[model samples]
Target chain A: MVRLNNLQKEYKGFKLNVSLEIPEGCVTGLIGRNGAGKTTTIKSILGLVKPTAGEIEVFGKAPVELTAKEKQQIGVALSESGFCMIFTIEDVIKVLKASYEDFNEDEFRNKCTAQSLPFDKQIKDFSSGMKAKLRVLTAMSHKAKLLILDEPTAGLDVIARNDILALIRKYLEEDPTRSIIISSHISSDLEGLCDDIYMINDGKIILHEDTDRLLGNYGLIKVSSEEFETLDKKYIVASQKDRFSVTCLTSEKQFYIDNYPKTVIENAHIDDIIVLMLDTSKEG
Target chain B: MKIIINNTSMVPVYEQLMDQIKQEIIGGGLKEGDALPSVRNLAGELKISALTVKKAYDKLEEDGFTVTVHGKGSYVAATDIPLALEARRKAVEEEFSEAVSKARSAGLEDDEIREILEILLEDS
Candidate 1:
């Protein structure tokens, strides 16, 4: 549903060059730490930021070139941007109703009530969780085929995060063909929701792997320096040495499980992947 | 069928899913010709990617535990009872061997491990 080919955005010292593909019926995650160019990539895809080089195609056309009707096919909820703070939920609903032909006012209203968001209160008075819910509800209300959610669950408590994730899941269930690109620093959110993940660092796409393969194949092998010295290093992707032991990241987890039965092998989570991948230590 | 996913498991979610479904089928909780939930429905219910559920369903079909009819969803396949039983036994044997290995690594005697197994079997 969306494709980026060497999409580059330059800003002073920070440069983002990423190539990603979000196929129809897939939920792709863009994951990285703060200042890792995730928002830049999302903005580039949404055509909010003009790319310094390369191309982005959304639904077979450039995001900037999308017609009004074509633009309606994509729903967006940006973290730092939303409706005017002075506007109430009721007013926001009215504005959305006028803006999108596919907007379902009843669904929007019911969701707001269900979420316990006061329709008469200004958005400025809403809690962070309430505002987050409103943003997601607004995005999903228009029946868009694709959702570009940038940190939809950011800064929310556990319950609030789960609620937002559930809303996204329900939106996908309503239409099996719908696709989503959810960018978040919260690894657990993407771990459960995304089919595949793209790990962005600094300004480059560091790693891209299917969630299944990542969970199944990636592992962290912990061993003392002596054990590490004797260990077969073929599968090791990255390793870091501490005072007494070493932690090695390996993509071929099964190989180690089969061969190094005594070695302490832990499952590599998204957080581990980010940390170890970003670690500057080399595999010897 | 109730499916529980352990997010922290070393086993992949899809594999965990497949294992659960296989167990349900073998234990008669899920019978032949029973229609499995649609990919989207199960994914939503599990709060997992539809692609993961689809992968499990595809693997189950490839292993002859389920059959997929386009637009009709997936259904439990008629089982070869002996073959299914053999597969279950093999899996249990592997688990037992791993348990024995772990017990040995923990410095348990062979007799102690066997006694523990027998006691567990009697309780079961």
Candidate 2:
């Protein structure tokens, strides 16, 4: 399990003070818009950045002070993390094998085969998607207990994105003891995959809940002006006005379904809830 | 296989998947006992949800149009789906007739509507 107790990281412009727990045997998606400290939180967890205050622990050990053996148990792939530009894919495989004692060459080769990345091709010659695939292969090859990826699919095409997601699913299936933390803006990727979602905004965790609970607890209510006026304002979390007003993305979908018999209570998608909860309307 | 999906189509994704597969089978592109791609494989290919593909596959199996074998895969059951298919085809024909009449009332000639449909069909 990964735990961050009142973790605080201060920058000239950004200060991230996030507290959350990522349960094992599940995917925890860290979601937020750009500049919302998603990457910073990931960096802190990986020990690439020093938290000014609070505590951070992975598998019950401080990530920064982790021994090489302990470090080998964790796999990290940040968007900007890549091999030396001049190194060929084969060279990367060799380097990773040397770096981690538990590296699985066969798994690395299989991933390379699946992605169709030529092992002899230099890293600098690869497309963004190819590079991302290489990073994924390297990360997975280490037989790590925990996998942390930051925007690994940011610039990838649909095929490549699907391939990456498939690989993650396969990995999870292979090792039930393993856990993953994926930080991305793609809500669909997390919708079914994540056991829990942690939404961070402006360097703080605004909400954290199990994926099923979030979906079950919140809903989208579409109503005409007449029905809108009858809605209890206390239950309303957020509202948007179009030709009509939609109110309170609540968890109890059936409450509106039964109470407002004539009202339409559509399922609230993860993206809609996040966007509404963040309430960009309140922002400049 | 001759298949099509519309981004602007009001049809939900699961229904679209089921319809496309049915149309492909009826068009003689997907034969009986043919092994369809796994749920994950098809979802990856279609750029949609795995759950959505599973929903379509579940409906297909429940209707006896396909059979899923655990630890093996999903396959087209058999070509003995006439009655169920005829009902679906008739529904489509009824909807198409309404659409055509609506087009006629909106000032579209038969030849013009055909040309427009041909253009739309060509893209898929």
Candidate 3:
């Protein structure tokens, strides 16, 4: 549904050069720490920021070149922006109805009521969770075929985060062909939702893997310096040394499980990958 | 069939899913010709990617545990009962062998390990 070919964007110091493909009916996750160029990549896809070089295609056309109908097919809920805070829920609904031809006003209103968002109060008066829900509800109300959600669950409590994630799941379940690109620092959010994951760091695509393969194959092995010295480094992708032990990241987890019976091996979670894969040190 | 995923398990989600479905079929919870839930439905219910569910279903079909008819979803395969039972017995025997080896490593004599197994069998 979306494709980026060597998409590059440059600021004063940081440069983002990423190649990503979001196939139809797949939910792809973009994960990284703050200032890791996640937002830059998202902005480039939305055509909110002009790329310094390379190409981005949303629905087979440049995002900026998309027709009005094509634009309506893409739902966007940016992290730091939404409707005017002064507008009440009713006002926002009116704006949505005016903006999109397919917007379902009654369904949107019912969802807002179900979420316990008061219609009379301005959006600025709503809690963070309430505002977040409104943004997602608005995005889904138009029956968009693709959703570009940036931190939809950011800053929310666990319950709130689960609720938002459930909403996204419901949206996908409604249409099996729909696709989404969700960007978040929250690994758990992406872990359950995305089919594939892209790890970005220092304005570059560091790793891309299918979520299933990642959970199945990636592992972290902790070994003392002596054991580390004897350990085969063929499967080790990245490693770091602490004062007492060396932590190694390996993609061939089953190799170590079969050969190194005495070594401590743990499955690598997304958070572990973020830390270990993003580490600048090379495997020794 | 109820499918519970252990998020913290070292096993992959698709493998865990395949195991649960296999157990259901073997234990008679899922009988031959029973239609499995659609991949999208299971994925939504489990809050996992549909691709993962599809992978498990594909693997089950490949293993002759299930059969897929295009657009009709998956169904428990009409497996050979005696062969299935024999496979399960072999799996149990392997488990016992592993347990006995561990017991021997811990310095337990053959008689002690046999006694423990008898006692566990009586309780079961």
Q: What is the TM-score of chain A alone in each candidate?
A: 0.97, 0.94, 0.96
Question: What C-alpha RMSD separates each model from the true structure?
Answer: 3.6, 8.4, 2.7
Q: Cα deviation in Å at residue A33, candidate 1?
A: 1.5
Q: TM-scores of the models, in the given order?
A: 0.91, 0.69, 0.92
DockQ of each: 0.60, 0.04, 0.64
Q: fnat, candidate 1? A: 0.73
Clashing pairs counted in every model? 0, 5, 0
Chain B TM (all candidates)? 0.79, 0.66, 0.83
Q: Which ten residues in a row have the lowest lDDT in candidate 3 chain A?
A: A275-284
- Evaluate model 1: give its lDDT: 0.90
lDDT of 3 at A207: 91
State the local distance difference test value for candidate 3: 0.90
The deviation in Å at residue A263 for candidate 2 is: 0.8
Residues A1-284, model 2: lDDT tens digits: 79999999999988999998877766788998999999999998999998999999988977888888888888888899778999997788788988999988887887798789987778898889898988877888888989999987887788888888888777776665678899999887776566678998889888787664555456788877777777865556677766656555766666666677777676677798887888743552
Error of 2 at A168 (Å): 0.1
* Clashing residue pairs in candidate 1 (N, C-alpha, C atoms within 3 angstroms): none
| Predictions in order: lDDT | 0.90, 0.79, 0.90
lDDT preference between candidates 1 and 2, better one: 1
**Top candidate, metric lDDT:** 1
